[model samples]
Target: MPETLLVLLAGLAAGALNAVGGGGTFVALPALVAAGQSPVTANASSTIALVPGAVAGAWVYRRELAPVGPASTKSLTAVSVLGGGLGAALVLALPSESFDAAVPWLLAFATVLFAFGGRLSGALRGTLDRPLAPGPRTVLVMQFVLAVYGGYFGGGVGIMMLAVWSVGLGIDSATGNPMRIAQLAAIYVSATALFLAISDARSSPLVLTTMVAGAVAGGFGGAHLARRLPARLLRAVVLSTAVTMTVLYFLRG
Candidate 1:
């Protein structure tokens, strides 16, 4: 089979997986590497290509954004955008081996969070409505750190954001999804911009274009399903996929 056709197929599969489960990188990354791109280049290309999908997914959930208090949204957005730039810079500066070695550990940590995240998030939801008024400083700090991680590596960030927003910031999952989507979109935009300005992204244009197209389609579908689907099943699927992909990443390493 032709490489272009193969990439487009992989992109389609990745889009569907990402929409449903948020592990699209697990598909696109390997496909890029197999097609002879270096791991670092593949990672950068994948991040760039995935941005449009994330945006589409976020737009699907845009209605959820309406109810969030403006102050909270503004605060999180600021931190996410700033942190994304820092993370992208770190990715550009890191040695390829170091980045590769870190991927497994990051994946493992995200998997663990997804596993226990439900109970934790449930406990915090009650507090979200009470107007406790915790300062934004801590949330900003955490967002910066997470955005850096997201921009640099780009897997499981959604789960991490869900946990943080639900548990740390005292937001319910339903409201948090839109906020998370916005934050992630900011991070992706910042990171992609930095990568294009300073890194070598020209090497994988074909792969990038096809993957983005697939992700955009899948994201729209996923968001639509997310609105209608039961939360329990969505959480279960997301957690299971994250764990399985983490294992795969470790084994591949």
Candidate 2:
């Protein structure tokens, strides 16, 4: 019961964080790990569990979605889907022992990316007075790579997407927000589909179902609250969570 409750709360916070910014994986992945799942299974399960929330967030921003530079929304989404599938396959192919050893370092890397993503985006944006105007190919390639990472271990994938768009396409975070959510949904959707088909995410049906329900509710509510809540407050809360979770994972290791 306690484990169930913990995951339920984690799902709520993870969904809210994803809706407000992009740190859902940081919350969901660790929670599943703590629930006694192996790192590989936890990662796959977390990805599956968070799919609904990302989709809900995407729906909320549907009308506002924009293309990344020269890439149309359809094109970007297609690349994200393909890349996500590949990443999921990679995860399933890895041995459990290898994945377990890598989890802590992955969490630390994600924490750093989440912590500095904004400032790094700003710095890169400042270097160019105008958007880099990378051709459609370059934009798609960058997105594909990020999508691969998103599928494999999503922790700060959203922030990385925003940063890439800001640097390569001269898109500001606000302007790119809708696209970020959309692409995240695309990646998660593809990844989850793959997970459900071949992974053991279904092993903990109760935990997964509870988290999904909470994520959906939280994602919807968070989308509405996003407009009212201060962005700094949201970012601070997520960063703290990410830091704490990363530390715990390292200690466990």
Candidate 3:
């Protein structure tokens, strides 16, 4: 009962965070691990569980979605879908030992990105003589790379997307947020389809269902709350959660 409750709460929090900014994986993955799932299974299950929430969040922001620099929405989504599927295949192909060892490091890397992504984007923007406006091809390629990573271990990928757009296309967080949510939905949609078809994520059916329900509710509520809440507060909440989870994962390792 307690384990189920933990996952439910975690999913709710994670979905809300993703809707507001990103970093849902930081919450969902560790909670599933603590619920006695193996690292690889937990990762896959987390991805599966977060899909509905991400889609819900994306739907909320559909009206605000925009092209990423020169890349049209359709083109960017295509690359994200393709890259996400490939990354999911890689995860399924790798041995479990590698995934177990990689979890802590991935969490740490994501925490660092969450902490410094804004600063890094600003620094890059300031250092450059002009906005780094790459062609559609270049933007699509970079997005594909990020999408692959997102499929594998999506912790701070949304922030990375914002950073790329901010520096390369001069898009601010406010302007880029809707598209970030949309791309994240695309990545997760592809990954979830793959995971459901072949992964062990379905082993914990009760837990998965519980988390999915909570995530769906949270995603919708969070989207509404995001309009009223302050962005700084949202970022602070996400950063603190990311830091805490990273520290715990490192200690566990």
Candidate 4:
């Protein structure tokens, strides 16, 4: 009962974080692994289950979705689906040992990325007289690579995308957020497709269902809460949770 409740709460928090900011994977992945799923399976399971939540966030921003630059929304979404599929395939092909070894470093990198993403964005904007957008081709290439990462580990991929847009084109985070949510949903769609088709993630039907239920609620409520709460406060709360969880995982290692 305790573990069940924890995973449910983790899903809620993770979904809320994904809605308001990003870094929900940091919560979802670790919580599942702690609940006794293998690293790879946990990742696969979490991706499969939380996909609907990503879609929900994307739906809320559907009308307001912004493009990265010269790259149209259709083009970016296409690349996301392709790259995410490739990433999901990679996870299935790679040995489990490799992911276990890399978990600590991945978590550390994600933690740092989430921590400094905004500062780095601010610095980039400050240094330039006017933020210039990256070429269309460049934006596409960057999105593909980030999509691969998002499909695989997906801890702070949203922050990475925001940074990519911020530096590549001086796009404001607020403006880029809807795009981030949309692209993320595309990636999750493909990744989840692969997980359900080939992975053992479905074996734990109870865990998957519970988390999915909680995530749906969180995603819906979070979308509404985002308008009411200050962005900084929401981010701080999510970041704090991510940092603490990352530290715990590293210490356990």
Greater lDDT among 1 and 4 belongs to 4
How well is each residue in 1-253 modelled by candidate 1, as lDDT tens digits?
4777766666766655665656777777787787778877777777777778778877877767842333467777777788888888887887667777777888787677657665665555556655433466766777788898888877777767766655554554455665666677788888989888877777667767877777677767777776676766777777787888889878988
Q: 1-253 in candidate 2: lDDT tens per residue?
A: 9999999999998888788777788788878988888778888888888889888988888888887888888999999999998889888887556665676776677567666765665675568665346899999999999899889887777767765665566565566767888888889889999999998889989989988987888787777776565656655654676677668767977
What TM value does model 1 have?
0.85
Better of 3 and 4 by lDDT: 3
Quote the lDDT for 226 in model 4.
63
Model 1 CA lDDT for position 233: 75
The TM-score leader among the candidates is: 3
Which window of ten consecutive residues has the lowest lDDT sum in model 3? 234-243
TM-score of each: 0.85, 0.83, 0.86, 0.85
Q: Which scores better on lDDT, 1 or 2?
A: 2
Q: Is candidate 1 or candidate 3 better by lDDT?
A: 3
Worst 10 residues of 1 by lDDT: 63-72
> 1 or 2, which is superior by TM-score?
1
Which sequence of candidate numbers ranks them by TM-score, best first?
Answer: 3, 1, 4, 2
Q: In candidate 3, which residue pairs clash?
A: none
